[model samples]
Target chain A: MKTQRSRGMTPAWAVAALAISAGMMVVTGCHKKTSTPPAAMAPTESAAAPTATISADPLSIDLGQAVVLNWRTTNASSVSIDGIGNVQVNGTQTVSPSSSTNFHLVAKGDGGTTDASVRVTVRVPVTPTAPSGEGDMGSDALFHSHVQDIFFDYDSYELRSDAQASVTAAAAYLNANPNIKVLIGGYCDDRGSAEFNITLGENRANAAKQALVAAGVPAGRIRVVSYGKERQFCTEETESCWQQNRRDQFSIDR
Target chain B: MKASRQGLVFTTFSTLLALSILPAAHGQDWNVLETGKSASASTRLAAADLKPTGGAADEAKHTFDATLYADLASAGLFDLVSKSQNPQATPGSQSEMNLGQWAAAPASAAYVAFGNFAAQNGKIVVNGFLDDAKNAQYPQIFTKLYNQDDSAEGARQAAHEFADDIILRLAGTAGIAETKIFYTKKDGLNKEIWMMDYDGANQHQLTHLGAISIGPRVSPDNSRIAFSTLDKNGFQIKVYSLLLGRIVAFSSVGGTNLSPAWAPSGQQLAFSSSRTGDPEIWVSDPAGSLAHRITSFAGPDVSPTWNPKTGAQIAWVSGRSGLPQIYIMDADGSGVIRLTDGGYASSPSWSPNGQFLAFAWDRKYGPGAPGGQDIYVMEIATKKWIQLTHDIGRCDFPSWSPDGRHVVFANDPDGRAEHTRVMSMLADGTQKRALTGAGADMPNWSWK
Candidate 1:
């Protein structure tokens, strides 16, 4: 061991000098037994303490938008972000937060541990003010809440008892707001051919329209379209999901 | 080979006269080339790379060769020889070709198709020829000259025309290489009409309506496309004029009107309308005038398709008896005959020969049943049906090619609309190929 150490002494000293200049204390241990003094270990132990800093680009974003968080650490052997778990010592990550969040980063090393954090503000979009004259009753939200979509049986367009009640309520709403026009879209589950479903959807829409008309809603006030199986309310293969899709949804024509 | 027997002609004029005379002479044997014939029974044909004459011709040569090869291979008439087995030499004329090499060894081609491409004065010219490799005495089958503007598309068009002529001379039927397929592609929440070459090239959007459009049926004259779309009024049938490059005004009959199908005569359209308080079959003029209700059934009658050959019968989907089924009626709505007794069937497209109807049918249409929606062809006279697509996907909207050899349809392999793709296959259900990436459906092949 002594002979091998003596033979590699010149290159080892060059590596130690380069390591010391670069502020890397780990490589100095390579030549420690040859010529290193005990006092040199003091600086190595003190430098073992880690320092970390984190920053977020823009620091604020609207809901649904993403913000980039970049972090850097010195002398740290391990690093992690609060929400993101473990991460590289220095890197950038993109995150979309639904609410305001503080990205906390922790760095740990032999000497000590250090932490830093950057807060990103997420701005929730404000809903636009509804047009005047209609009040809450005329708003689309209220209409959707009151009118409701009427479901149907598979391969059948006949209105059930529940569907008939929905039709009656929708007709009453249409009668109360005489100026409002309604468009009924019939949708089907993605089980059959799109062509057949198209006609089936039309049948459902027309059935709802006929019931509305029978309930004293003017036929001219309502228009019907069959979305068929093109648009789905739910896409699961389960019966419950498919039942949700086979329906006549009412919306404001305007 | 004798000097006089070398059938090489460079013509600067009378190109149309040559094309007219050649087909009349060689069109007798096309009936022997039937669909569903095994590849081993098909004529072994090889397409050589087009020899470029000028620097600019080199740029378009690759397109010409690839298009020509694809056209012939997809014709379902010939067993195409792969390029790897072809001889290295690209013969531009009969004098330059050595038939013995193509007939021997790896290629063993029965017939060889060779062409020369040139660019002159902003025009792309192709002199294409097919030769009987074994018959040195009368080797030439047909020689066609195609000239168009100097561009990659021009080269492709020239190739399509030349390949079509070759198919006509050899198979006795018109080739679909130069045809167009119109379909609906989803754009965000809206579906717009799109068009592509029959070989799935040159795909481009035709409509930017930002509204839902489906069921595009091209006119027999290829001048207009009739489709169903959603507007402020409701679901309506609109005619898009290809010549005008925009949607033309069609008189709407109010209520929900959808699925407009053109008669072979191109004068009348058959569609389903709810204007009379129920969805029924309606016949109208091309401009949606002179509209008259034909089917006064209790249930909805939709997706009307006319017998392309006779135009005397209209096959449609009717829901009069519980579930929707295929039914055929006379042009005036008399002589009603149910085609599919049970099972859900729709989108009945009549073959060009007027003998069969290709439609989408779910034979055992119930939850957890192994029978899924697939394309099927039903013989109207016999009521014997053959399932074309087995279980690859849920295939629908099967439209027959004008030659009655192929069917193009939409397939949803993953059971999602966003994953739907336009697919085409031989009428026998072989050679299935996806023509679009995804998010496309309701394919309508244009009538020649």
Candidate 2:
């Protein structure tokens, strides 16, 4: 509580700084952060409170198409959006949601908080275009695009024949692109405990990493992480959905 | 010294013989509190308002008086006789209490608490006495005097001390009057670590980690809180020192780390980390040095909770046998034993007395599930279990209170998705009460 930390940080450490800034605010004996106003959230509604509403003509739209979001606040001093930063209390903005996303409109006034949220579900595009950089990618790019995920059986993390084939192809791709470092993110279906899922997911990720290393891909080039059941690939209780969730998805590290 | 020792033994034997020959006092009306049967019929108590005696004693008297009554009622072991139900007696000392009258009639109170609180000359004095109305000859069972600062907080402290004394003598267990609870709350958007009283009062934010912080485990000494938060490293466990009120650096990095459990001695911390390949139980000091893997099983092992009574044993969840089950092992990872055999079980919390374990289990996990997850307590020696909650949507992360008489857990009472409220109940599944509104979860009771 006696000293304040310097908030300056490099780009690589920006997320860490902002995350730890919340803890630093407490350390400096202050509840308010100078960098950010207060954290934004869906404020609990109270009686006779500040009023806000976010409206849209169509709550659903085609992927990559724009939808106008109009907001109105009766007694708000300021308003902020999720992706689009702060805007006028009463204004309009065109948003092209790539996925099912919720736009939270938070209004701050003298009395208290006023918040309204609207979700827009993006319809699947009729014609699927090539993924980014796909049009001009060489074999390395093709390999990068072709790298597949390794799946696991229910409650099992051992690498199977099909998953081992995927890992073999992935290791070949990494061998061609020697400079590309990858991170393996493990995920699980929402079946058991959240805490247990962390370990199961990490073991899945490790199983993938071990396969790639056994196939001659440098172990140093791969890192492992577990999203557990937090970042699910599917939300249904069906076998197909659970199968899709239990896997190791690979990504190139920045 | 030897002659006095023989005389002391003779006096104790004589007193026990005399009490055994006495008739059953209060009959079946009092047997409910003495016998461990139908504990839902809690003990009846009447806390007479403290008589103010000196200058500036009104405010202190009010604070102490309300705090004592609230503590007694919240203990879940007593049916408090409200002020209106009292027999208009302000007995400040043992001589003033009329045992025969209180034992019968409208008051009908089996036990009575009478006290006097005075704040005079910048000092406060509290004199309290417990009277068992059935013991007519020796109605006075206990008395104590406390001297403290003449302040509001001091008054509350005196009440907590006095209530603990009464509970210890009557309930045969230590009271959680002074204990605190460490938990996580989803206030607005930020899920930060928070602390509150054992009775769910005086709640305030303890950590400002704006990221999603979960699984808060306070140290045995109440000096630090160990929880995991998602930062650039993705859910790295952080230790916040309560004394300095700041985050201290941890040596755990390079992978995901979470679910911290402190050994009762406060010397070692056991948590789950994937730093050495896969997530396994890792032990280290609070400063995060001397880290080593204690569980190197093929399957994943996580959520390690140490037996609070002894630092030599640990219990955790393991996915080794197809599905996750509760397992117990030595602190050094030897002498492993699987305590659970079927269904999905996690969040195994060892009771304070080391006689039982409380955990959340589905017991019916599959397609078309039969029942939702509920809290269950298992006896370590006999392997007997009794469900504490049933059909309550989903209840998880059950932690035992400091006295080991009750359990507090997070439940989606309304069956709403992802929303939960804090709840507590007796270990036998009686006297359930909601401790918090929506958006609070993962409650951990403090060590007394």
Candidate 3:
């Protein structure tokens, strides 16, 4: 019986080699795996060897996206995927792979053990870089991000020490980009009257502009507007929020 | 002899009520005389629902009755009797009215106002009467007849006219029921100009500009509205002509321009302009021609409001003395005098009689300040002020009603959300109520 079984397995090995080559062709085409054909078993054998095939619906996916892996096996008592433990004999599983991975499936049956593999490639998105430095200063978003807003004390337009530092840095940026004109909008907290705050906010803006001019920024390149209490940056009754509201916000003219 | 003496007293009282129709110089003292009178002396008046006569629609009669009752109640010169206390009979004319019923018991009304409404041939006709409830011999005070379009709006207009006549006879001042209020309403990220009736009815947008438009000041003639708005150039004053229903061409000086106030003569405008480098008070003709800077100070001077009674003085907000303060100067910008001693004060609105200036003041303005920004009315002569709003909210932009009996302002009560509302109240800070919903700002009452 053993001799006959060995002889039967010989032609099965040859057929297995041919099926493996064919599976390689399929794999090359669409990253799918086809199992080797069932070995030619002896007629007296109790069970046939398992045949398995596995494939990914979409073999490629962007990072942070999910992909479905489908596998089918015949004559197998148990089947298991490499990363995802045991699964049903014929089923699908969804996976969000952080990186490219190879999904390997193994099927075990009374006749033999069968295996298949599929590769899923995850594509990482590329981020666009922002234009920076002198020539690129024309963008308003870049200008505002670089120049900081200066805050004032309650009901006072006098530039505090920290506000002066902000003004100096802003003047440096303005001087570096001479063609860029700036608009200084003065804002105030909601604590005071809207009408009185109009003048107060204007004074705060003018105070910043004067400091910028003193720091060598041209006065003609700067325009000022007072939002008064009409537009408040922070509505909280807290002191910190009020400080945020009383500020000289800088923006590009265009 | 006793009848003649009573007739003489009635004639004298009628003369006092008619003082507003006199020349400007004589009318200047009208508010003083009226203010000296006590509110306790307000006449108890009852307004009966309008009776629907032939072909009068129920909706029109309902509108007329509601408007008439609201006008008299809000007039600030009448103790309006509740509708529940009214007699069962709704008199449509003098013959149908029982004055004794209104003068006794729950109503005890000194005067009874009854009216009838009729719609015929696409026209609305109303017969309104006001009678002294106690004086049976001379019960009739006045009778008014109104004929207008057969619509709810027509009924409302007729009711307003009758209410105005009643207020004039009883309060000695023009009624504000027929007046309009121009304000700014937030639209998306922008604010547009809006107008509504004095009682917060018929609110509609006037300007469709999808930009920030605020500080609306209607012209004395009710023909144009001047407001500050952002454009491609910058902050500039624009005029909306009510006659043409479009924006009229106004000269745009290159700089920030804001807070356009119309002189009572309707020929000049006072505004704040930064055209000359610093924000200063400037005056120009109604057409924005012949513009000249009247103030040339280092600090910002803005929010110019004219003394409507005299048309000779200008009150504005100035920042020259550290914090902003209310200051008054001549029309040409001479004889400058500061009215507020300390704290933050601004948005001075001159009363029609030139006797008081209503403004916003933060008496103790600072971080974690104890008192809130409030509205105050100051007697321009004595400089003694009365706080009109107390800790209700950050109230500002107090615009006096045409009759000088009420003030309209903007109140910001919600702290962080920045939801602001336009509010109105009597000059004494009583009967406070909101005129517009949240996001309404800078209310300016019409001259009429």
Ranking by lDDT: 1, 3, 2
TM-score for each model: 0.73, 0.69, 0.74
Per-model DockQ: 0.28, 0.36, 0.23
Interface CA RMSD, all predictions: 1.9, 2.0, 2.4
Candidate 3 per-residue lDDT, tens place, A1-254, comes to: 00011212443333333323343344343445565555554465667877777778577777678988888888899999998999999999889876667788888888777777877766544313232322333566667766899888887889999988888878877877666788899888867655556667777888998898999989989888878776677767788888899899998876
Alpha-carbon DockQ of candidate 3: 0.23
Per-residue accuracy of model 1 over B344-429 as CA lDDT, tens digit each = 89889998888778999887776667778889877677575567787787889999898888899999997776888999987767
Consecutive 10-residue window with the lowest summed lDDT within model 1 chain A: A1-10
Which of 2 and 3 is the better model by TM-score? 3
Per-residue error for A103 in candidate 1, Å, reads 50
True contacts kept of each: 0.42, 0.68, 0.36
Q: Tens digit of lDDT per residue, candidate 3, span B1-448?
A: 3222111100122112212222233222121223313453447889998887875357877888899998887766777899999999888888888888999989999999898888888888888888999899989999989887878778888888999999888767778889999999999889999999998988899999899898999999999999988765456899999999999988957767889999999999999887776788999998788899888888878999999989999999888877788999999989998889888888899988887789998877765567677888776765655577776768889999988778999998865333788899877677789988898888999999
Candidate 2 on B244-264: residue-level lDDT in tens? 999997878577898989999
What lDDT does the true structure give each of the candidates?
A: 0.79, 0.74, 0.78
